[model samples]
Target: MDKCGSAMEFLENKNILITGATGFLAKSIFGGENLEGSTKCQETLFTVKSSKRDDSFGTQLIEKCIILIVKVIGKDLFQVLKKMWGGDFDTLISEKVCLVPGEVSLSEMGLKDSNLVAEMKNQVELIVNLAATTKFDERYDVAVGTNTLGVKHVISFAKQCPNLKLLVHISTGERGGLILETPYKLGESLNDIQGLDIATEQRVAEEKFKQLEESGASKEAITSAMKGLGLERAKMYGWPNVYVFTKAMGEMVINDVKNNLPVIIIRPTIVTRPSTVILLDMLQVTVGYATGKLTCFLAGITAIIDLVPADMVVNTIIMAMVAYELKPSNKTIYHVGSSARNSMRYIDFQRFNYQYFTKKPWINKDGDAVKVEKVTVFNNMTSFQKYMNIRYLVFLKGLEFANKVFCHSFQDKYNDMKKKINFVMRLIQLYRPYLFFNTIFDDTNAERLRMDIQKKDRETETFLLDPKEINWEDYFMNIHFPGLVKYVFK
Candidate 1:
């Protein structure tokens, strides 16, 4: 359309193409059907591996959206979606949403014709790049391939697009592990990254990578090579961790090449679920480790989990796009995270559990209700487990004393109980690293700009980022627990 300032005006008639259309951030924006009066727009999603990856969840999202959209338009939108993607992912999409499917990682996106690329260059008005390898434990080589080189492709494609207006790149809020006690202060980047040309570096790196891979180098060897790349990056840009290191490279790539085209960088922190999305519980490695390890928690455990609900995180991303597009700023960054105002500590979760489940309704087998005169929540988990062992020894001695006196015994019951408690404590310790640590993300910019609503050019309401928005209590009691029982166990 015409040049405009606000996202509403900016997005008017804009054909927006998004990579990582199935990721946490994009999933949040795709929830646009939930928004009241959000007029449908022409959009295409690029998810690299639709069949190979853990995309069952992503497919569900597509299905849900298409269903919702069909209800709204009261007409067939499936054909439109099919033409966009060049396939029938209609079952994978919801309400007749226009969808274009292809892997963002590969050149030409695995499409049959070069014309599709030409078509994308012609029709698409805006692009959102969210595709990347977020796995921190990923082999460094693969991470760089997807996160670094894939980004270069996205940038190159965007540059080729004749109608491109704004290319909004969704990045992680913690681009670097660098933390300042204050929010506004920018710290040293992991790499110097000064005067870096992302596209050129990618071309050179791709040759080197192919050479090494062709020789059949071990994954470990390739990883070492990638780590070496990180050093070169660190020397250039000052960031730590492969994920952030490449993302830092990504940010530079967009900044260096982008001239007049407006770009918005939206970063979100570790995404999880307090309520909405189902958390895994089948594998002993499940969210129910809270309940699973309750006994062990009376013993000391370390390791804190860093997470936020998926919906909240996505909500922020959508808000950032709207706010930044509405914003006059060009090539700006918005850290869309929760550390600034909302801090949910592991200590609080520990205290909440100890106060309820163990005390009043804590019933052992045989329908016998036993109540200790008083129970205090243990802060040091390891010490609590040690204390439990000591108590177990003491109880054995007491049983021996009573077995001789009463003549009949409680030996078998006590041993089984002790064993269970011990197992529970171990489970709690297993969950420690994620539960106790502070990756404490800060998003001062995102919080302010996101969730602002206007009606007739006047401010109507503002949004709040409270974990309390969805009941944390029911999250554990009903949904978290029952969902585990139904979906995971089954």
Candidate 2:
């Protein structure tokens, strides 16, 4: 990703240190905006700085440009200049955004170079930490260490950073923890602090894992032991799965100890493609890739992929930070989700998938587009055979024969494919409780944050990347999305 003028402008004046710079939302919010407001329906906020379509003039969120424009273009040259300066579009944001080399696993954020982390800690005003093991089946050790313990370290470290005004922690909405209301207050501490007293939970897990490490257990045995621990520990957590359960713990830890730090928690819903910035499409997130999406590629079928653009998540994070400045003392939970303002259902997503992927695929596999026929869901996984089995078997058999003709065992290949498909389906169903299950998010706080952005009298700069201020359908269908088929597979 090459740097541009707008990227430079957005980073001006602000010394921000972020943990996860490579993730989708982290990249989108810090990167350039779509300028035309990107493709999200939720009422969120993000800062966007862009160079002109050509290189003639530069463009940014708004306020930054107002000052320079006043010098040359003069006040009220166009509209009520003072009132519009904060929301001006011809601004630069390059100075505010800065990427730091930081990771959560180590004591000092894996930064062995104390001088560097110290320098960053000293000069940085806002410390944004979003890095975590978001993988659903992630091991208890990995998640707890990076997500839970790591947060403790950040709070402790941020306490030392004299310039640190606010420490914005990014979280997931699915960390719904037995709460029934919108303005949910902080809850009980996630007792998994020491990893489930776990070794004690299942003597077998402890003995097995220890033996494996002590004797250098075989890879397969270690893998099986790890799996056993995950299953046992997950059942103990009481939530739907480990991903949310662990994140909830991380949040609790952050809330309990973060007393004096002007902090806020921003929890985003199922995050997806960029809501604004566009990179060369390097790769898709593993969680997104393994389940709903890969199913379509294997069968060329259409199914709704329900996700909020990464851009929206990042924008919401920045907005939450700005909101911190106005009400610096409040320690509240702000949800960056799509429960109310803008939500399209899974069935709607399924409909779109069926219509588009089948007819106008990006690759044209057979020199012409290949469309998929409609599919029906079953209450029984075993029933795929009696109904669609024969059809799928036919394709499998053909592929097997071709592989054998080329001197390979197509049977083994088909067997592996079948196994992987079945595994993905099981995990998909496990997560279905969140995706298929109907859960409403009340983002009244998110709405109030937007009000702050829209106010002409507000001193904070506007990014124009407001979610409620744009057309969702056009951006999602035309500019942002589609890469799921065109680029992810490519």
Candidate 3:
């Protein structure tokens, strides 16, 4: 379908409701022109404002943006925005941005303000659902509540908005091997498991909760049990972990319940933000190695690791939103990742990490340069497990007996070592699917959307959603690694 108007023209006087304002992606959306030194984003905003659309359009953006954030992260949510605008931030917020405290997991999005809800229903033209629990091993009940039921609630809310044009749901591309830009059919799963019902899954989680409660399980025990249950359920249905499984179910909910409302699902893979948490597993491990804590790595060294800049993903979302507004669709899926167009291998990433750290070694608290080494890589799980057994597991087993003879003096040390090992093993299990991932995110639909934007003159040129343009080596060496040190590690 061909959309008629430009993004600027379509967005004119629009009221947008964005859920999960506390999230990194949502914040980036709010930042708009003030992202990651993106002068292009700034230029685009000024260009749009300067355009001769109308008297009001030239003075301010079309969006009267509303955001929903939980109290936990809402305390400092606007600090960055405030920094960007300084004294004028409050005035700008008063005029354009509206902050609402709520939880998407609850019915009506936990939005209790009746008058404000009424206002949103009357004026909201677009809805972007960015609320999600990204923990790979999150509790089953919690994941479903936010990821699955959350979408249902958002849709229910959208149905109330008389002027709603489109709803954009931010999802992840975690399904392995040639992931496509296609909608998930209700009850259909990656592993082809039958009877994969959302209602059944919800029931299962609730029943498990009841069982734990009846057994007088402690809060910590319940949390651990629920986390294991999520992974268990996910693996049973052919997914790797809790986050992706629940998110996939979220998409299913959209397909099942969206009764003719325009919808777009954007699946981004391993999105990296400058000062925010980088979603890639390798980067976390690399951090350990950089600090001289990790000596070996487990991964399919040759496997392709999909990576995309967060700003690029945001740009794609914006383009998709405008496209949907111009040409409404019942459902459309876009895989906004680099795998299909520009792929990076784990081996190359490893080399880059080594090169970067070796050249500029980390300094310890003692003011000495920590030495570096090329970590031994294991291509298979068996080898990795074997290595772990030989290297540390055997010693821990012996330490179990030694603790009894030493008046339990070594008990604390043994416990710490065992706990660290368990944690590492758990992390490895959860991340193995990605570390050895063999997938290509097909972005044909995304490319078409880019082409559509391209045809409408270069005004939309600043939205650089194309992954093929990125130089991976240059980006990691000069941009990603240094940013990690400054913003995250430091």
Tell me the tens digit of each residue's lDDT in model 3 across 1-490.
Answer: 2443555555556777877765677766766442323221211110000122233521233321211323222424346665767787655555565655556778887665588678778878888888888999999999999999989998999998888888889998667667878888888878888989899999999999999999999999999999999999999889999899999999899889888888889999887762232322236776788888888888898898888877787888888887776666543898888888889999998899899999988777788887889999999999999999999999998998899888898999999999999999999989988889898888888898899777764667766677888888888887777766664553
Across 184-288, the per-residue lDDT of candidate 2 in tens digits comes to: 224432343334432243354456568778988887777756765654565565556666756766776776788777778887776655644332233232213
- By lDDT, is 2 or 3 better? 3
Question: Model 2, clash count?
Answer: 24
List lDDT for all candidates, in order.
0.52, 0.53, 0.76
CA RMSD of each candidate after superposition: 10.7, 11.7, 7.8
Kindly report which residue stretches of model 2 are placed more than 4 angstroms away from their true locations once superposed.
Answer: 1-12, 34-102, 175-211, 276-306, 329-331, 379-418, 456-473
Better structure of 1 and 3 per TM-score: 3
Q: Which scores better on TM-score, 1 or 2?
A: 2
Assess every candidate by TM-score. 0.60, 0.68, 0.87
- Residue pairs in clash, model 3: none
TM-score, candidate 1, is 0.60
Decoy 3 TM-score against native: 0.87
